[model samples]
Target: MKKRFVSMLCIIAFLFVSICGRIAYIVFSNDFTVSESYNSYVLNLETLYPVIYYYNLEKLTDNRDKYAAVLRPNERTLTDLHNLFPSSQINEITNELKAGYPLVKYVDESKIGNEKYIKTFRMSDYECVQSQLISKASSGLLSYVEPCGKREMRFHIDALGRMLRGDEGEEFEESLSNIKGIRLTLDKKVEEIAYSALSDMQNGCVVIMDVKTSSILTCISKPDKSYLNKAFSQYNVGSVFKIIVAACALENDIEFYYNCSGKTTVGDTEFSCQKNHNHGFENLSDALSNSCNCYFVNLAQKLGSKKLLATADKLGFNDDIKLYDEWSFKTANLPNKEELSSKGELSLFGFGQGKLTVSPLQMCYSLCTIGNMGVKNQVRLVYSSLDENANEDIVKYKASTRVLSEETSKELLNMLRNVVENGTGKSAEDSYHKSSGKTATAQTGRYILGTEILNTWFAGVYPSENPEYAIVVMKENGKSGNEDCAPIYREIVEKLNYL
Candidate 1:
């Protein structure tokens, strides 16, 4: 009996020792990880950045009135969760919550914990305005959570939150809080106007810029689902290229008069005007107003490839416009002299055809140069950044350069006004503001039902006398610029007049 009792005591002591060792291993081992559900974390909200469009009188402003927030799953039943998220999304939501993670960021917080609600990806109005920008500026920090749980979590994150989290790097580490929030030149009101105008289009874009500052006010791209911003994507520029041709003619002092007999031929290639309509006895101004293709072709021959391309280069052709770090406008392209060796190719190039392509943002800036009386300001989208203390770190851009003579720009502006007053761009006339612009119906070389598809465009400036705003509107697979795009420009301008 005494031997049995001693053996039992030894066995119990060994079991106690084993259990303590196992617990110690689980607590101290690097290879072991607690379930996220049981673990808590201090999400450094300061690490997550906020993006702003405007504040006070500053162009790129960040007051932090609006910040990034996440949707935290409250104490809701499983059935309520199912109703709040779709059947497909419910599982993901539940899994994320079970893992003690946020459901998603930048969600509408007012609707949280609503059991009767159906699943919708509803965001706050401010979030809707700056969602794209926030996604770019956050750099995945918004989704990252620390594995600490000493303090309660806050859903809203901004620069102030960063200050409270305390700096945890080298003592000399630069505090970029003044540049904390990504500041953009985009105007929310103007953005809404542009968006509403293109909402019905299958695929298109609208770009608006301040002529003097070259700040982008509104940029809207259709098919809202596309990751590509169509405003920065290149498309074949039609008659709008005429603006460049006209500049070349005026700057080089090239003058000519051409009688269009519906079509012109060069190197066995027959080029016809729109619907082959004959433009009789036209000079530079008349040709521009009528959008006469024959006149430009003749003009191109006179200027030749060297002079024409020189002017195009001066106007920022074959260049990528860098709006922000790593974010840029797709480079605009033009054929080199070797490619335009023949008169036929040159003729096509003259009328904004052949291998010429430009992004709508670039097109808008080209007009803005003219509106600024030949000064080309660097196109800007991001204005600056705000730090934790709401201090601003303004982004310096390249200085404006004179790309065209003031005299030539003034003449071109008048010609553009004539286009809106009595030419193809008549549909873009704004009653409240004197608008000037050029229209183009570019052939895409794609045939649908045996009809050549066209990319229509209308690029213009508002209050033409002293241009303040330059706007470009583009539509894919359209019938005519005046019919499809110019009207949209007019609507945008008229609405802007109220603002």
Candidate 2:
């Protein structure tokens, strides 16, 4: 009987220890009990997209990979997460949140829940913002997304949809999860200007970047009716591609003069200029400024496909630029080098015709390299991101590489400057900011009811004397670059001067 009693005592002891240990784990182990109590907004500077995903952490492993996938830890620290969500005044947006959007507060309790401010919320409340994040976390499709620009901004949301935070540290009040996200490098002034230009258009995209920092200043694609914003869309490059041809020629030392009688025959295929009028004798610089197609056709044949591909590669053509570790850009597609053996094919490739398709961002970055004295700075959208932990992070981008020699880039810039000052891009010249850019009209064999459509482009760098920004303005089914795009470029410069 004593032995049985001892065995019962042992069993009770084991039960007590197991219960205590489990309780201890629940109380002390950080992983067992979720430590993260909050989340902030996330944004992309390069793509102009906002990431508004909020996940319920059921242990870190369950949602970490998925959370990190959308809201990348670009360059933010959890400690400063409060900055991502400021204490701003309660406005119409706050009213909507009170009526039902997820309302979250990061500041001291004293700073929130006052009149004209958002009501404080619980992270676990289903009717609160936390619940919305949980719902989205389980959802296969990201549903909480919103545009940060060109909309009526509620607090941090932007001028009701047509603006964003202008100066940092502007005193605003908000007690909600929606009012949080990183400020993109996009200058509201620039974006407003570009948007104003394309406001009436059905399809077009404009991009302007700081040459030195490679930070996007303005990125707007018109008629943003679809989630597929056309700013990231691809197009046939057209003649503005002559810049690449010219650069390749300069790189390969295949310089020569050509006399254009409006057109040239390549294996029985006639390549004609837009004017179709003889340009007489022309030097390389003059040909580029005049946008003489006959010159580029001959130049491409002389340089051959090999040299053209090399220069295009150096300029990041047919490649993807990984942006802030959030997402990679789509590749700028090009045709196979060997396929250009035909003189007719090489002639088309010479002036950016044929199968050369690229995105506005890629073209902008390539021009940025030329303006940056031939060095290519890694293109980025956001300076940093606020991770789930609220940590602020700045990406450590790769070192700049020399794509064009200093001399070659200088000559190219000079030619481009002359283009604005005297060539087809003369209309883009501005009194506030002298600009030099190239204009091209890319033809899409796709005709609309018998009328052929073209992609009009004006790509150039600003303050010809001191390069600061590289801009590309493109319009689909538009006229030549000078007619449809140059005027818009001038307007962008005028706005930049005011900003």
Which one wins on lDDT?
1
| Superposition error at 291 for model 1 (Å) | 0.5
TM-score of each: 0.76, 0.66
Model 1, 66-176: lDDT tens digits are: 323333443433456543445776676666666533433333344445544222233222234433333433321122222111212433222222111121111112233
* Each model's Cα RMSD: 8.4, 15.2
- lDDT string, candidate 2, 324-386, tens digits: 343566648877867787778888999988877888888898889889889988876555544
For model 1, give the RMSD to the true fold. Answer: 8.4
Q: What is the Å distance of residue 442 in model 2 from its true position?
A: 1.1
Off by over 4 Å in 2: 1-183, 387-391
The local distance difference test score of model 2 is 0.67
lDDT of the structure predicted as candidate 1: 0.73
The TM-score measured for candidate 2 stands at: 0.66
What is the lDDT of every predicted structure here? 0.73, 0.67
